[model samples]
Target: MEARERVVKMGALKHHSIVRRILTLVVSMVILIALVNSAVINTMIYRQLLTEYKSKGIAISQSIADSASDILLFRDPATIQSLLDQHLTINGVAYLVLEDAENNIVAHTFVPQVPQALRTIYAGKRTTTATTAFHRLPGLGNVYEISQPILFGEIGIIHVGMSLKPIHHSMLKVVAILIPILLVVLITALFVFRSRLRFVTRPLVELADYTKHLAGHNFEQSLPEQGAIRAIAAEHNDEVGRLSETIVSLEDAIMTYIGDLKRTTAAKQKIESELMIARQIQLGMLPKSTDNTAFETVKIASYLEPAREVGGDFFDFINVGEDVYIVAGDVSGKGVSAAIFMATTMMLIKAKAQEHIPPQELMVSVNNQLIALNENMLFVTVFCGKINRYTGIFSYVNAGHPAPFIKRKNEALEIPLTGGMALGVDYHHYYQQRELQLENNDTICLYTDGISEAMDVAQNQYTEARLAQCIGQSKAVSAHELMDDILQDVRIFSDGADQSDDITVLLASWCHASASVSSELGVHFTNDLSEIAKLHQVVDIYSQANGLTKTLQHNLKLVLEELIANTISYGYRDHEIHDIKVFFTVVNNALNMRIEDDGIPFNPLEDAPEVDHSLSLEDMPVGGLGIHIVKNFVDTIHYERQDHLNVVEFTKSLGETA
Candidate 1:
């Protein structure tokens, strides 16, 4: 109510101010017009009155001159005086005079005597037309003094005085009449105009108040119909009504927009939550970094940062028999869909690489799988390679991916590409494999375009030349340090600019290291019961040398005994001797083991029987107990058939549980 009152007061103030200004302007104009009209009327009346008085004075003087001409010829003063008196009775004729031929006044009608001022007239001077002159006589006031000739100046002239008092009196009377009429008209117009103005301005004032009310209130709610707003809208059929209607419609639109915005905001929040979860899942799909000591011949490190909650770039590295397989890929777009595609591609690449697929073959296979599954026609660029630790030979394939830098003895050089299209574009696209022999301590840096194309505030890109320069300038001694140096340099170059794409970097450095009791342990023995003791002896020596926990050693002994005993019993159909190669390494508090045996094909990861916890111990399966116990003791396991050999690899974290 208080707000409404304020609005009303404001509207009233505005209305009154406008009305008062308009009234003041109009009244001033009316008064000025009236004064001008009165001036014009007075001028016209004065002109008409002066002309009439002069005409009347001229006639009276002429009549007296003619009458006195005969009267003076007989020398009759009585008749001449009578004629002068008779003409004096005419209005505006102040006085009349008659003179003899000898300039003697024959008859005159002044107050008591004719003033001397008029007596100076010379009758000797004649005029063909009657002439008049104005003068202020001593007794008579202002008058037009007319001198008339009598019979061509043979007789004396007649002097007639026409007073100007009638013109003054007539002007005064006109003013009196005009002033009253003007006042009456002005008063009437003012009253009518003020009344009509109130009628017109009242609605406008209400509209202003209602508009102010609308501005103060929330527009999300429907406008009330029982107020000044409604009154003005219903009562008027003009611009005011249309304006009110438009305002109401605007409020409705605002309400709808606010509702939709709320829904959209909630939906967006939900999608963001889902995307965050998906980001975690996508990150989980990438390979976890292992300790540098895990591989005796290569040190590996990787860095990945998505531009958004989820991104399209991915990297993976895994041990492939005697070689280290590494891959880096980038999808075409960013966000959730790209992340999904990236996860799919990474899984495919890892699975194919684990199967001992070559770099070029893996690209062809993963590309076909992606093409069959890609409904959005999205594609991914990949650079995959296999580094042979024993031979220092690096074989790689580039599928429309950026070239990697090879840092050899402090010199950074780009590895030339064996051209191939990005995956998922054409299923028939062929990819070529290129080989480069790696030297000891040589670092290979693989990265996505995000590193090279990073922009600064000036829109300058951190190009490939910059990457090579950064790599060349780096004083890092290991793959992890070099990777960090490259990433840091890129960030410094970007200088707080927005990241436009996902960034990924993978580095691998090759070096020679002997297999010793400190870092690694390996042995080769026949699948004979006597040689199982040799495996135990080697594991015991390596554990004691490396300070491994007793529980880890026990778990390792139990798993190896179970797997090798099963292999000797069931893995071979022939009784001939079969050799098994066993290697162990302690990397970052975890024990990594690789087993290769030239026996019948067996994949312990999949061929292992399922252990049912629901069954009693006596009812439990018999053939799968060894594999089940091995799985329970180990953290991870991978099995593959490579070159007719069953290779089983597993890692056990050095935690209390084993």
Candidate 2:
């Protein structure tokens, strides 16, 4: 039992010794790691400070050289010496020297009591020296000896020896500064490292806890993905940069996905609202059927096709007793603003029609209204007319509007009328009225510019000539049939092209007349004396048809003779050959005659010489009195120059005097 007890004691002692040795080894290893880390950090700080000191020293040296040269040039020795003394007082600038050409120091500023051996060694050097010598100096810790040779003209060399007192003082001051700084850095690093280690380890611990929690079906807390834990795992390189970029990309993708959903929902709502408004506005702009039955024998058919969600086309019909007013207009541009303008135009036309205003007067009012409200310079093209339904007389006005096609018994003719500028361009514009006598079963077709300007896939317009031909062929069809044929033909020509603007059409036919009086006469005359007899025939036709009084016939005969003689003499004066065309149409108890010439733009009203009527015929300056006689007897005369054709129309309203 005693030997067993001793063996146990020995075993316990050996175990204790082994534990103490392991503890000592661990402690020594910890001290070594700490010492190595401190040495590395200190070396980095020392190198940084040394680099700063070297740069400062070089800068100071260059500055001193520049200052000395400036003083020598200016011959200012006091300023040079003062600058040297100031440099010596600054920290880290151990010494400063300004020497003359002779081997004598001109200005030397140094700390007192430099070492003797170092001074002797510096003095012995023959050539200019640049070396840092270490020495012991009085009242200064370790010192550096820097020597340089200075030359000023042809004198002997001047040696400059300066003790590096400021440098030593700066080094001692650095040590003093470093003691507290190092202490703070050490304490801060210790706390920071502890915090960082915890920061790194805490996330790992949390991840482990999360795994444990997940095993228990609990996913309440999330792991922190950034900071120290991420730094350790990321390991700074391309991998870290890529991981950061990937996370940012994923975040952006999530944000974009959410935004897309919101935008889709809002867009759907907006489209629905727009469609509803378009349906309401479209239904409201159409003419009501209750007002159509007031006319005695007037037929009206219209079609409005909207290209998009809204249209800019509009048409209206208003009947007042025996008269009927019709309007077809298109506002420029499209969408909501155009729709608003269309509504305003419709209301203005309706209001003016209700006042029994003539088509030309109504157009002038509308133009003035548009110009007043037109801050954006928006204009509308309108073709407006008033039909004396009982008399079968069609009076119309065009405001830069496309001409309507008239399906006569024999031909489809565009109404030959002058149009003014578009509405909203100028308030002073005047639209002229034109009258046409429509017989029974004659159809008048009016349309918007969209029909003529419609383009095919290849961008070819459905031209006006093609439209005229189409109407001429379909004159026998019903109003509805005519509209359908024209619209279908336009669509076929367009060849599946996108509808760019609104398409609108209005067709009206006169089915009866109270007193069908036709005074249609044609005369062909040239600038020749032999064709003068046709003018008598023209006056005779008008006199017999209207049963004109004897005095009116004489006046008409005199005006016709004077106009014919003027054209035969002076119209073809410059050209060798020229044909004159005269057309006469009496509608609504008014006789209208148009005279066309290919001659130059000369207005008889303007160019006709004023006659001193008191002079004798031979003394009358021969050419002036003829046009003056025609102007005095005519009710109204107007001139227009279009292309190369000069047209003058004379209106003799039989209702005015006969």
Best by TM-score: 1
* Runs off by more than 4 Å, candidate 1: 1-14, 70-91, 97-125, 136-142, 202-309, 316-327, 331-334, 344-405, 412-441, 449-501, 508-658
- Candidate 1 displacement at residue 167 in angstroms: 3.1
Q: Pick the candidate with the highest lDDT.
A: 1
**Compared with the true structure, what per-residue lDDT tens digits does model 1 show for residues 313-368?**
99988776667898999999999889989999999998898888789898999999
Residue 168, model 1: lDDT of: 81
Pairs that collide in candidate 2 are 101-152, 101-156, 102-156, 102-157, 102-158, 103-156, 103-157, 103-158, 104-158
Residue 370 of candidate 1: its Cα lDDT? Answer: 96
